[model samples]
Target: MAKEQTAEKGITSRAEDFAAWYNDVVLKAELADYSPVRGCMVIRPRGYRIWELMQRALDDLFKETGHENAYFPLFIPQSFLAREAEHVEGFSPQLAVVTHGGGKELEEPLVVRPTSETIIYAMLSKWIQSYRDLPVLLNQWANVVRWEMRTRLFLRTTEFLWQEGHTAHATAEEAEAEARTILGVYRRFMEEWMAMPVLTGQKTDAEKFAGAVRTYSCEALMQDNRALQAGTSHFLGQNFARAFGVQFQTAQGDMDYVWSTSWGVSTRLIGGLVMTHGDDVGLVCPPRLAPLQVVVVPIWKSDTDSGSVLEAARRVEDALRAGGIRVNVDDRESMTPGAKYYYWELRGVPVRLEVGPRDVAQGQVVLARRTGGKVPVPVASVLESVKAALEEIQAELLRAARERREANSLRHVNRDQLTEYMEAGGGFAYGGFCGSPECEVEIKERTKATIRVLPDPEFRSDPPPASCAWCGKKAVTEAVWARAY
Candidate 1:
């Protein structure tokens, strides 16, 4: 049996040691744990359950939008990756190569896919023959490896699981429209389902995907005042189609290359959940995605008296489960009720119910919300009360996150204000740029912040405005600068 440690104080008391606290919560909450490998983790049953719920929600959304699931090879030929120039340069540093197979060295090395664009497009060429065969929409859920210099569990691991969607369209306009449609799906999933708000915008030239003509992302601000790119959708604009010779016959009897798009959201979102809503007490999971929304613990003075308390607890659990809520009754005799509370709170369970002799006599159960303190709910109205409480907690978390983002974001016209903003907890800093690479470079050197995104349609600076932040020339467009993750 595993040795039990003494119940520690709540997480709020140790907010200064966030990193250590996070590690503790992950293990204690039974979410995930370190594996034998250096930078890999084993997602325990509890963690996998949460991921399964997320996958089900997303898969349903994808299918509703006319996408089908498919699988691709885990290994891609080295030559395939080199087909796209910009893509090769961007992902080369992260590729894990395989040089030997069947116990012998091979002539051509294979690379574990960092992203599946190369292989997916290679097949797309053969599959697309005419305009009738265009608009191929496919998605795959699988594990990917990206050799990393630093690893942090789900946030930046060497290997992680995610879903990547790739599509082809007959026309450039159609492809662009598909990209935006998927971006909307992602925004909806993150905000409505995950209960985390985001900033949706286009990526700057320097920040776009390696081979994409344009990239759109949903960015969320973490509690640390840093930005996390939650998901991305890219418009390939015939780059992959041209490289792989994917062509379709037009109505006019002319052959033309197909336009492509790809978008993805990875397990890194779990990290966003931990950072955005998590308090000093531990993880604060949004109700929609929480695996076990309500846990009921029965308290008794002795094993003989446990029968009555257990009956009351079970009755309450049945009522909650009937209301379409995920509920669990903790009837373990090995630990005290206080210890169980600590465990579930660390795991971010939204609500907890305690039914004991005294509470049963009063026809009520002691309810404790993870976000707020304890309250009492009548047994008769427990179902409605829990439903309302969970919704309230979800809203409170989103509001708090939005407030932090607003407080940290800054707009500046000069260097002095920019520096002041950075020192006072950095966030999105807006300033004018002349659309020159030279000015972009100067800004990065002066402040460690780069242009994260440029306004679409390119907002030009009006006359009589301040010069560029770096070049001291007439500015072109206002840009958002920040130190990104």
Candidate 2:
């Protein structure tokens, strides 16, 4: 009986097998399922709801920052990609070409977009003619295909849903500002709503987005102490504009190319949330972004007790709903109270309320928190308690993640020290870099760790080390290195 319950309700120990545990939690919680397609997965209703919440929050942020949502074609002409030399070479391996459509071969081949820069820029070139159209701030929530050889559920897949923001500006400074602004938006969204801690900085040239003059990214440390690139914002700096001849008449009446930028965060964030906050039991979703905030579970001894207990549960649920809480009453007759607790816990519902005949008689109910611990609250005070509990849980999760990141992060003065740290169960290593692509490549080959970020002041110190941590050459910047997902 114990073994069966463990098998049915528990996942593989995270310490023993983190990958197996994550796959089990994702499947058993009904968040998603493997699809018939070789490297695709179906987002079940439960998983989609979480994504919907994320979309609503992020969309509102984008709109508030003066970005309007729009749509673009999913297919692009092969010639457009060719116009941008580095962009085409960067995406060549992942390009999925469509040579035939409508049951006939076409004269020109179309490529499913890995990213929309080429096509979007072509349209921008047609739409802009003067300084009046200086900045075109647009975003699109759509699906993209990259033809990935290896895939994970939400982290890396052949096809996935995401939002990409592309903007055109009159000056390089304005374009750089737009990219950083979006980076701030992404950092706040990930840290505040998702309750995840991240390091924000510039990516090294070798690791930056292809065709971008500079790329900025947010890197989050997971429970397993590996890094995840949560989101990125790229400063295109007239590269795409020049490729597509997006020349705009300036205020001074001169014809010059416009500066451009693109930034995006995808469904992979869902996977980051899981790995950052989840445990051996299952996912541990932060309250502000959880699909369902509160679940009401009723406990009854007999049919007689069921009548009163369920009535009380409904009253509690109605009260919670009236208090502006997302609530659901689990009244399944076939499942026991323990079973319901396990079910809701596995799904990472922030709070669970259990009402029984005794609680109803006493005018109180039992509250269990997914983060851990239980308390009892009177009917009159349940709302306040629930709200307080959720806020506390959200803050606690962020605090815990921050502490874990700090604890695991290390500062090394040389390559030998970096190697020792990597061999001893790596976290993030902060060191000085010479800013040479060849040096980064050699380091990756030796340690399997690449520069994750050239961290901000908060994560980096003043006056970088005197020489490169790896080569003892002139140090250009401080960088955080890690083995990533």
Candidate 3:
């Protein structure tokens, strides 16, 4: 027992040290590690596996919506980025430029893509010649570089992998519809698959993407009571098409520029998952995204009973695997069963099965849930039990997260109240806004919170009741403000 305690001793208590607990889990869980380069991280196999599951689920959703995958160059020409004024101005501060190559200085510097809108739209200009090519739905899975002053692993790294979907439509309405549709996909992915609750809405004009007419996002409340913009969809509204000269001939003997949209979800979401569901012990991955949903461990007191325990564990593993569950059996002889428990728990496997000599003798297995605690299950019904338990754990996590969100959220009219709440670690604060950049700036300066999103038009059955939170004038919209990651 003393030896076992030593192996698990280093993880910091969550309440005592939240930041250290997070870093410990990220490193001890074998998910990610600090890289030699500052502001960069190396995602290990366990972390990459979670990302792979996410990619597979999201790819299916994209394909279902008439989107196709494609690749773009890693570097975008300086001239291409300059084509869009707002985009260039917004991204200039974070741009990583390559001034030299092949031991010589280049005439025009190339930028590592902070985002792919510029480069992709430039190609769309050439591919779209006629109205027949009106709607080009393409997405790319790639890595982008953004020079951040401070970084945190998957949450704010200098370089991270993501998928960006860029689409061209014949009309503004179609483009806007596509943006909302993708936003729905993101909401569903976060709520149903990842078991994370999110608030879906539009960004304020001041907070919208640089070149977008409107931007939609799904924001999730972290355990720390701060909001994370999990994903965003932007309605370009001909901005990029006009900049890139992506015009197509119309059927009525005329020509018009295409309307475009771009949306993305990045590795930052992995961080959201950690902060939202993880506890003091380690990560508590949702069943749908857990790379190994169940792990079977065989416990034995002596070498004489090892063969029987191993056989029984393998049988249980095969049963789970046959049920379409990702299962692994840990049969390493050198490590004790207690050590194996700590190892898999740190890795965030959602469920674990213990098949010891006693359990095998009784024709049963002991089940342990990573999200909570232990449950004893019979071998005959082990498959069904595991399945039901996984579903329950997933639902419970979402429900718990939703409750935390509700508890932390605040709706206020007074500016003093807003500032006080934010200073005390606020969640989502909803208030009336005048839709002025100055008002937005004032709020940001007073309280380190920005306008996260505005309530959807369809949800606004009631009008704004009072003046703007920052300015004393008739409010135009109700917006959510929060300290964001």
Candidate 4:
């Protein structure tokens, strides 16, 4: 992370106001800033580096799953969007259409990409002519415009960056498997790399993607006890394939429309990272994803000692770098060592090594873990000690977040309890849903809460509830409800 930015003197305590506190952390840490255009943000160097790390991890996962990387056009012909009725209807409200180009009105308007599904399918139809081309696994990283009315910097924005994966398969089973597999990949990354635990499940009919047969997601709870839909994978059973004529010959030599799937995770995750682990002081970035994992701060009392301390600091930095850690040495003349600690903590550097005249003389330095701890380690052993501390911090964050989510959650909640909890306090509530959109809508209307997911086996209530949580009717299935971001 960049080391020169100054953090604001005060942060709104999360208890004072979580929304305000979030904004304070993002701006004060120099993660992002407001741009000239409304509803847009300029990702600063530190923020972009975090996003870059996230992109690389996800890209590698996609490739390992046998998916290819490709690019699609940003502008789609207006007629292309209408090829799929449900898709067009769902996106119509947010579409940004371009009617004039080169200072003259084009014969037909073009739509800025809200997603690449429609355009990708149109090209797939042209490319696939036989059974051998049964599975076209591809993903593209690109920017999308959704024209959000009210936007939050990384959570919701008018235009944002993301990776969208599109694949075509000969059978519905293959497509369904692909969708589920992607969701698993997302879950693994969230827990292993980001150190954020998540629940996986299928979204209700009312909440599934525009033209999807089914949609699955990874939902994570923020520190404030609100749910965040972190990522989604959709199974499209010949919906887009039929609309765009993406057909292939079968082994029997018959032509049939192909089943398809699409999934994606985006920049919104950066916001989730902040909420998941950040403290009142500043961001507490997960070590695996942090751009600068270790920041070495050199201390001194006099000019004579300053030179030796800085030399020790540089040597420590080189050793850590050689050990494959992202490290930075701060030896600026103006800022005191104490100021450097505050600055790095705000930026979420996972570990800090403090070197001083005394420590250098003793051939040791004070090794500090950002999560909270300090120990003295001999100069010769700095690399190994720092690596172990980083791993411990990563595991500790995930463990703490999982415990918090469980502590605040409830099961078998009734209508009265649901209403009271949502109004007075908020957390995940598991109960039965009647499998009716009308019933779900009524609950939302009254409580401003929605079903997060019909959770997977590990998260479901043991011996599920017998009646609907809201209507008191016979239960159809269990669902997790929460006020979400």
Candidate number of the best lDDT: 4
lDDT of 4 by residue, 1-485 (tens): 22222334767778777888888889988889989999989899999999999999999999999999999999999899998999999998999999999999999999999999999998999999997987999999999999889999899988999999999998999999999999999999999989889989999988899989899989999988889999999999999999999999999999999999999988999999999999888999999999999999999999899899999999999999999999999878899899899889988999999999999999999999889989999999998999999999999999998999898799999999998888976789999988988889998898888999999888899889999999889999999999999
- lDDT value, residue 412 of candidate 4: 96
RMSD of 4: 2.8
User: How would you encode candidate 1's per-residue C-alpha lDDT over 305-336 as one tens digit per residue?
Assistant: 78889999999999999999999999888989
Better of 1 and 4 by lDDT: 4
- The local lDDT score (0 to 100) that residue 319 gets in candidate 1 is 98
Clashing pairs in 3: none
> In model 3, which regions exceed 4 Å deviation?
1-8, 457-465
What TM-scores do the predictions have? Answer: 0.92, 0.97, 0.95, 0.98
| Ten contiguous residues minimizing lDDT sum, candidate 3 | 1-10
- Give the worst 10-residue stretch by lDDT in candidate 1: 455-464
Give the runs in model 2 whose Cα sits over 4 Å from its true position.
1-8
Q: Which is the better candidate, 1 or 2, if ranked by TM-score?
A: 2
Candidate 3 lDDT over 1-485, as tens digits, reads: 12112134557766666667778778888889999999999999989998998999999999999999999999999888889999999899999999999999999999999999998988899999998987999999999999999998789999999999999998889999999999999989999888888888999877889899999999998877778999999999989999999999989869999998999999888888888888877888999999899999999988779989999999999999999999999988889999899888878889999998999899999999997678789999999999999999999999999999989887755688789889998888878888889989989998989988886764332545476776768788788889998
Candidate 1 residue 290 Cα shift, in angstroms, is 0.9
Evaluated against the true structure, the overall lDDT of model 3 is: 0.88
